[model samples]
Target: MSLEIVDSCVGCFACEPLCPNKAISAVMQPGEPLFFINPDKCTECLGDHDLPQCAEICPIEGAIVDEYGEALNPLGSLTGIPLHLLEQMREAECRQ
Candidate 1:
């Protein structure tokens, strides 16, 4: 299966060069520019690496996803913070 690059990508250019298939590229869309992955060219790095290089290298959580629409780098993955803890912190801030 292939991976998809969602709008959450901040155009950091971190995943482009790392892709073995050269599937990811910058898309100049109006309002906000973002990177995209060519589904036809994407192979989830099955033959190249243990994990998808793009997702492994992407700094933004939830930016890269599988064909099933599941995030490869979900929230709290890079931050190492639990989702519940983050939510609690937000609630505490709101109460202050």
Candidate 2:
């Protein structure tokens, strides 16, 4: 359950650093910039928050969406790889 920023994003850059997993990045679009969430890195704030911090802090309503583009609500689309597995993978890759 990764969060995605739709085309409706106002480029407010509000969701970038707020991600605990460091999954969000800024991408420049034709007119306004957009934020991209790396699904591989996103943990949906699992093991950290009771809910997604991005959706909680976003000022623009409906700007943050779940993988299915549905409005993010509490307990919505909380799917992502387990944090421990991801960290183990990273550690193994770094050792190689």
The local lDDT score (0 to 100) that residue 52 gets in candidate 2 is 84
lDDT (Cα atoms) of all candidates against the true structure: 0.89, 0.76
Which candidate achieves the best lDDT against the true structure? 1
Residue pairs clashing in model 1 are: none
TM-score of 2: 0.67
Per-prediction TM-score to the true structure, in the order listed = 0.82, 0.67
Task: Show model 2 residue runs off by greater than 4 Å.
Answer: 73-96
Cα-lDDT of candidate 2: 0.76
Q: Please give, for residues 1-96, the per-residue lDDT of candidate 2 as tens digits.
A: 688877667888777878999998888879888888899988889999988887877766557888888877322223355657667887999999
Superposition error at 83 for model 1 (Å): 1.1
Model 1 stretches with alpha carbons more than 4 Å out: 29-32, 88-96
